[model samples]
Target: MKEVRLPTIPEIVIILGAFLALVFSFTLFLDLPIQLALFISWFFVIILGVRLGHSYQDLQKSIMDGITNGLEAVLILVSVGALIGTWIAGGVVPTLIYYGLEFIHPSIFLLATLIICSIMSIATGTSWGTVGTAGIAMIAIGEGLGMPLPLVAGAVLSGAYFGDKLSPLSDSTVLASSLSKVDILRHVRAMMVLSIPAFVITAILFTLTGFVYGGRNIDTEKVEFFKTSLQQYFDIGILMLIPAVIVVVLLALKKPSMPVIVIGALLGAIWASVFQGIDFADAINIAYKGFAIDTGVAFMDGILNRGGIVGMLDTLVVIIFGLGFGGLLEKLGVLKVIIATFEKKLTSAGNVTLSTLIVAFLGNVLGCAMYVSLILTPKIMEDSYDRLRLDRRILSRNTEVGGTLTSGMVPWSDNGIYMAGILGISTFSYLPFMWLSFVALGLALIYGYTGKFIWYVDENSPSDETEYKGEKVANDY
Candidate 1:
């Protein structure tokens, strides 16, 4: 293995500057696709590696290694594609939308959307699943209700990420906890100190927004027509929901996400045949090509006409290229060098904790993988926390809050791209309203500045005791 060293600040600025400029041009002047933009970004990182004395072959391997980091997510995109196809084909999606319009009042729909998605996401411990299934339906309902797509997308994302950040079942949460050596419960509790207020504030904002927008004023004749079309096209019944219910059970049992979602797709396909009377061959075909819904209603057609194995192709391309860029950055030690510079200034618990957020969030944005942030932030902050006498739980909490929340904000991130594609909103359009990210970031900065809950080194250190105003503190972890 080649030895990697800390990069100078100028090097960091050059690399980041080039990547950002390219991305901005793609979005602003060129109007190229995200995948293409990311592909170009990967080339920039590869060039950086080559400039740093790495071989072309080594950079090539670094790209592949970065791509490897997202293989699991790639598989998930495939399964979710199939799941969407089969679920809608089996009337599972229609059932949710149908019942939703009936029971979920339009005026309160935004608030309702946030609350239900939060509960479902937390229960399943998988944001993608919650978003893919329930989120798809929520967006459809938003369209049916005439609400702004970005607002609805923001509400849904905030709620979905809430569970993804705090739930022990969430991979990000587990990775952050395990990496920092904090018990899962302690990690969750420490996070709740900030997350609770965030959630409450978010819910209130959504509620207030909901009251102002009151979807009841919009004509629902089209949405009602959609439900009517669903009834006439196939057998819409309770049995169609079994697939979603089974997924809930499997998730509660701690089953792996890939198989659980695949099972849901399989069961949905089966239901399409047995109950909905779809031809067996056709049901299987839907899983591959997605359900083609062409109702005269444009909004309904848009909602139902999604999800198949092939549907994920565009997203897979973006993820591959994005990960390649992130991977190259990691292999070249760009991010580590930046973290090293930050570490040089850590003088107190507040400074260390606060700096950890900056490093972790930057890792999420620049690294393009939440896992990378969860891994790299802790590795870089380990010494600083010990020196400041902060508990590992604080590190764990900061890691997840920053890592999980920021991924969905960046337009090219794996999560961000997937969500924008699914919700049919631009990543930037919905980012502002993702209240969880805002609240979490705000609260982290507050904790960082105020020094509340900040622990100190032990006063009994024979040699180092005099360096810090150390005191006996209660164990938080």
Candidate 2:
């Protein structure tokens, strides 16, 4: 038997640099499709692993394990497609948009979207769910109201991410907290520090921007035409909203997002049949193949002509390739080596927090999943924090913010792919508008470097060091 060796820093850099070069060349200069580019990159990484000492069998296992861990997200994503299909067909989404377009004055549209999405995300604890459902409807309404697609998307994402980070029900929050051995409640409280200011600042920015665009001329007749058309196709009534409500209730009760979303999709199908009089065969088709809405109104048609399990197929393919590559990288032990290097190099106790945040951001960017980064960040940094007498909760908070908040910003990342697919917009289009991401990252960096709100170890009891609390916790948000 041969003893395995870890990758050196130079080898790690070479592997990562090659991967990045491939990504930029394929996605940027060559203008190749992302799915194919990912496949090529994965091949390169796999070959690199073999060039080292690992066998094909080991790499295969890593790829399979990566796929396995991500299966839950895959299923939820597919169900989200089905949910969108049925919700639209059942008149749920259109109904929401119908009211939203009419009542949400353009002046408050962006702010309202941010607030609504934030509430939904916090309740569901799943940003994907919030995006597929409320986020989708919000975009349609924004378009109908003549707002820019990217701007609306940015608002939705800001609120969705904020709520996702703050929500105790959020899977990422739980994973981050549990990985750091911090209480989820404690983590949520800590996040409030940065969360409050970020949200407040983001809200302020949205408001200032709103005062300019909110009063724009609205197309009431066009919007009303959309509502009337929606009524003609499906039963757009209070009853159609029941499925959406059920999912919210179930999620608030802390039921796992998987079954809750499945139920929501199935209920949408049933509602389409029971209330809208859709045929059983057509109902099944809507969930699987999605509906093709052709209302003579081009804009409304464009909004409606999306969703179905089939629509999510492309996004799912991207996830498989991304995670497959991430899995291989994790198996290479490159991240482990890099973390050890960071620990050895950092001299200032304060720099520990900054390094943890930086590594956490890189984890989500490179690892392809927030769960992957959240888990890895703590394992790599917990020892470093303990040695510096930093409270572990601080580490947990930074992990959530850096990892969860940044995932949506990376174009090739899982969160990025899912949001782009569901909203029918490019990830780059909305990246700049993700105010929460910018604000949270900025505040975290400031707090870390300034030693503001950073709690330290009490020499007497290292284990019980949270006695001193930092006033800020946007970390969880």
TM-score of each: 0.90, 0.91
Q: In model 1, which residue pairs have backbone atoms overlapping below 3 Å?
A: none
What are the lDDT scores of the predictions, listed in order?
0.78, 0.81
Model 2 lDDT at residue 136:
86
Residue-level lDDT of model 2, residues 1-477, one tens digit each, is: 455677788877887887778777887899887778778777777877787788889999998887776676688788788888888877788888877876888888999999999998988888888898899889988887878889999999999999988888887888888778777888788898989899999999998888788757568786777677777776766777888888889998988887888788889888878887888779778989987767787767777777898988877887777677668878887777887776676655457767877888787677666656776788788888887777777888888888888888878777887888778789899998999988988888788878877777566652632422333332332
For 82-187, candidate 1 gives per-residue lDDT tens digits of 8889998888988888888777887789888988888888777878777888898889888778788899998899889887766777777877887776667667
How high is the lDDT of residue 186 in model 1?
A: 64
- Top TM-score: which candidate number? 2
